[model samples]
Target: MTAATVLVVALGEVRSPVLESVTLARTLGTPVLLSLQPLSEADTDALGRAGVARALVADLGEARHAPAVAGRAVATAAEATGATVVLLPTSFVAKEAAAHAAFLLDAGLLVDVATLRLESGELVGGKRVFAGTWETECAVTSPVAVATVRANAIVAADAPEAVTTAVEPLSVDATLPRGLVLDEHEEHPRAEGRPALAEAAVVVAGGRGTEGDFAAVEELADALGAAIGTTRDCVDEGWQPHDAQIGQTGVTIAPRLYIGAGISGAPHHHGGMQASGTIVAVNVDPDAPLVQIADLAVIGDLQEILPAAAQAIREHRES
Candidate 1:
């Protein structure tokens, strides 16, 4: 029997989740093929250390920013590599691309996958559903499987020894869809040195309890080298941008460590972060829903607690 091949698709700057996908692919005992844009020397070296057997580089140009175009490239690479399973890092663009690839490949598509394994020669993904209250396992019955994986789902580890990754150019149809045209795009400005919220292993979030001032939250996040997130209420209040909101209507994250301040732990918000490996909640309301589910709960005013916590962390590191 021919060995199964797994394709990991990553776009733009390589992130931790992308490395995790590569690690998972290696764990599958399959020939791992990486489909991505042209890489720099650093990225190429990094992938080699991560155990990529081969890389398929597609020059999508401006179309690289478009999910539909990237999806086409992913599909093309999968076909060329004879990949039976495709893994993608969970992001807005990746989710869209997964849909497009699944449609083109006639594969079973799974999103927000937190665990993946091969069961009886079939790819099975474990994910949470119904606002993070239910866990289910889905096995792909189709010839091919495509899944978008959440960050921190798997720990990234280096290969036993670095191997030279053969690089091959992949051709993709860069034509835009009808009525779509390339336009100027602007990347959202993030705090210097802070990780992206969606992919960060540690996240510190604020809510309306901060009363529109995120100073405490920011300090703590900075001290911990963590990403900053906010509740929907904070976004509506203009305390933070929409991209920072974490809720059912906003971004879903499953970081290793999540610290929430002044959050009520509403079902909508909990649903988004319930998958976090560890949850710490700081709020004045002892009865807050978030406090109930938190692995560690502190009943106090965040304005006072956050700064103190940040200071203690900084002092410990310095000491």
Candidate 2:
């Protein structure tokens, strides 16, 4: 059999799955055509240079998601391109889309793929499940497979010999589910300048240990220009928004640096961040679970420690 074609589900964001997909695409072969939803011209241009030969842009009008539509369309496109494997970003929406497409094509579905290898005759993928403790290998039974890769799991390695390919624009029509209205999208003002919470190099997170005051958390995050995240307790107790939660039920992130303040570091909470490169904790209770996993554990109230740390970081940055 000839080299298998890989269809990558792209995020189309300014700095995300666009680079991620293209990198993996080059690893598979030369022709890495990107399928985009909606993004700026600048983003498209940048992606174009990243070895994306084609852009199969699907129009969904003003509706935020047309999953069924995109899923079917991507599956059809993949089949036509003779693709043997489909890859998607492991985000909430991309996960749903890839699974749906795999079902439509009767292909195997693999989630949370961390590492991939194109062997002599077969493709192998590595997965870390159950809060980064167990390492699992996934080898599909079907010829056509669908997999979603965890963010930051792979480096973007592009080849200089990549060339653009022709695009066969795909379109779809379907009725969406009820009460799923995307009336308007207020772009996160910070999205343009600040790093995304999931993509941040440094993340500052707070938990129930902070009690009700997140002032220190905010100050520290501001000083570091880091996105603020939180544990489930902070969300459940109404001290923080649900978006801030980081756990099995919340967002999973693999940032370079993660700082925990007033967070007890439950296993469920750590599950979302155990993949982080560096972990620091500041908790009054020395017995918190975070202390065990933390590279640096400080036994002090976050309220006092955070301000001092923030000042130190600021001073270092200035110097």
Write down the lDDT of every candidate, Cα atoms only.
0.87, 0.74
Model 2: ten consecutive residues of lowest lDDT: 185-194
Candidate 2's TM-score: 0.85
Query: Which candidate leads in TM-score?
Result: 1
Which window of ten consecutive residues has the lowest lDDT sum in model 1? 27-36
Q: Which candidate has the top score in lDDT? A: 1
For residues 46-155, what per-residue lDDT tens digits would candidate 2 score against the true structure?
65667666666555554425566557766876776778777887777777878778988888788878777667555678888778888899777676777887777766
Clash pairs of candidate 2?
none
lDDT (Cα) of model 2: 0.74
Q: All candidates' TM-scores?
A: 0.95, 0.85
Error of 2 at 30 (Å): 3.3
